[model samples]
Target: MQTRALRTGGFDLLVSGLLAACLLTLCGCTSDRAIAKKEKATHVVPVKTVAVETTQVQRSTLQPATVHAFYRAEIRAKASGFVKNLQADIGDYVEAGAKLAEIDVPEMLMQRQVIDKRIERLIAEEQRGQAGVRLAEARVRSAQALLAEASSQMAGAEASLAASQAEFDRTEDLVERGSLQNRMLDESRMKRDSEAARRDAMASSIESAKAEVAVAEAQVVAAQAASDAAQAETEIERSQRQEMDALLDYATLRAPFAGVVTQRNLEPGDLVRQSNEVGRGQPLFVISQVDRVRVRIAVPEAEAALVNPGDEVTLTFPSFSAAQPIVAAVTRTSGSLDPSTRTMLVEVELDNQDGKLLPGMFGQASIHLDSKVAAQTLPSRAIRFDEEGNGYVYVVGEDETIARADITTGLDDGNSIEVLSGIEPGQRVVGPHLKRFSDGQKVAVLPN
Candidate 1:
């Protein structure tokens, strides 16, 4: 029993020893944790910083562009006819007024011939009527001369009749007084009767001449009317001929301006309908002036306001990558946006004297919109973003304390970012690992 009691006492002592060791170990671990906390409070984090600088910053956008001719035209037929001769073909260069094709219009030719014949006949008829008018005028003059002659004869006959009557009266008075013979009185009476008959005949002749003059004048007016009608008919035929000539001119298709033929739709002998006709065929030719080329771009509304005439543009053709890009200035821009597309139309003109640029070619255009000569900027690594997408930077103060500052960014070129606000030139900001630093934390700036 004594032995069992001693073993129990020894087991109690072992337990007590273990308890002391455990308590001491716990105290040491607690002391080490306090020391670590103190060291952390006094520690200074080392960081790399960059100075904010004022430099030139440029903003640009790239958009798809298409090359177009300075002037383009689709030449269509104005007169329906079968193609007879093709003077121009695809890729042919032509000057202004150069004939491109000729059309064979048999019906038009027949109509023109008929008009010519009709005009000739009308002209002849007009001349015949004019001759008749001249003849009528001559007859009028003859009739007037006859009337004048008759009037003179009538006056002479009347004078004679008056003298004869006086003689007869004197003779009769002498006979009654036994101074003259009855035969003498009878002779005077006979002479007076003959003069009166001559005067009456002359008066009748004057009336007949006046009636002839009236008839001649009426004939002259009628002849003149017929001549005027014939002349009017001739003029109407002439006007029809002029209209036919105009229509015939359309059979010869000529170039409206100097250009290269880009397309040819009809061959010789092909029937082409007039452009104004229903169910018209394709155009005869498409001409494009390529001495100068236009690069057209549709700029989105977001950047449309930044685009303007005289701005520089760089054109790169994907199809011709090895070819050097063309540099030109913006020629113009549509001030308003397209309602359907919501994009602004912009154009750039390039001199293509070498004939390298062609219509329908596509490329990309890089346009410089805005530039700042002296803008505050920070390295891209120095900028950080919050959960709301707002950008901030860790600014290192003179006392080496870090401060969080919100900044407005303007343009970024991958390496550097333009700081429009909340920063100044010569200010230092943390370069990278921005999350490692906090507001009011002390830091040691590393040497550049």
Candidate 2:
């Protein structure tokens, strides 16, 4: 019993010594943990930072519009006529100046034929006048020859009269002196009287020849005048024929432009009058050019300032096919807004190289009202919402401390938000660790 009491007392003393050593070790570990936490608290908070930058952003709006052809016309008659042939029908594609229909104007045709016949008659008359002129010239030559013969005869008669008178005087003197007989004297006197009569006749013939020449020359003048009149008449007839031919050419109705014939109301053997007349007349054909089309979109008044000429656009033809939209640009616009609808008319031109677009269709145009507008931007992660749902961002100042900058946002493209006011560009902003940052807290910025 004495030996057992001694061993038990020794085991109890070892247990007490082990408990004291453990307590000492636990105290030292607690003291070290306190010092480590104090050092960490003194260290600055590390944060990712970004700079506010100016960049471009686009805002868009869509408007309803109608598709129209670049050119459209209602072909109508310019002159009264009967439709002789119907060459084109609705939905037929026609080229420029292609014949669409024909008219039969028998009156105009007959008048043209009459003018041609009149012209031929005038030509024949002119030829006859020319022949008459030749005949007149021949008569003038004959008269000249006759005048020459009459002058020779007059000269001969005068010489004979002179000789006869001389002989009569000698014979009378001889008879008085008894040197010549009375019969001889009487014979000489008779010869002289006969010569004198012949001379007077020749003189009359010369005058007649001269009068004939004058008449012939006057006839030549008259004939030439007639020929000139005929030539003038021919010119007049030619002009009349030209006018008649122009009227007859109105017989055929042709296309004014390359287009599709949309309407055809006249047929063969139908009496069609001029469309511009007092009575209500139907158009022979309605044609529309569709190779390219125009879409007039109405832009709202609110976005008028953002739209301008040469802006890119997207056109969707919902009525035709919505799968593929046509891309084009704003070609023009109505500078003034509509008072009733308060919308401005904007026009877009689209190319239809594949012939998919047509006139008289409904479409939608997406217009880039504004794009690439310069603004202060921040990363989307930097924006924070307060209790009132107002947006803000953390901006680090020159002292390495953050401050809450309340900004009015313009556009949010999911990656960045536009800062309309309260923040300038090139300023330092807290990027992702925005929420953890408190106002006026010091932060260590990491290189971007």
Q: Which is the leading candidate under TM-score?
A: 1
- Using all chains and alpha carbons, the TM-scores for the candidates as numbered come to 0.68, 0.53
Error in Å for residue 285 of model 2: 0.4
How far does residue 67 in candidate 1 sit from its true spot (Å)? Answer: 2.5
* Candidate 1 minimal-lDDT segment of 10 residues: 274-283
Q: Write the per-residue lDDT of candidate 2 for residues 1-448, one digit (tens) a residue.
A: 9999999999999999999999999999999999998886566888877888887766677778888888888887776887878889999999999999998888788888889999999999999999999999999999989999999999999999999989888899999999988989889999999999999999999999999999999999999999999999999999998877776766788899999998898778888876665335667788988888788888889888678999988877766573877778899999999999999998887776666777878877888766567667887788887899788888998888989899898776446778888888788888876246667778888787
Q: After superposition, how far is residue 66 of candidate 1 from its true place, in Å?
A: 2.9
* Residue runs of model 2 more than 4 Å from their true location after superposition: 1-54, 58-64, 136-221, 277-281, 296-311, 330-349, 366-371, 376-448
Candidate 2 positional error at 126, Å: 2.8
What's the lDDT for candidate 2? 0.85
**lDDT for each candidate structure:** 0.89, 0.85
Query: Across residues 330-353, which tens digit of lDDT does each residue of candidate 1 receive?
Result: 999989999999999999988888
Flag regions of model 1 displaced more than 4 Å: 1-51, 56-64, 154-208, 277-281, 299-336, 364-374, 377-406, 410-418, 428-448
Which ten residues in a row are the worst by lDDT in model 2?
274-283
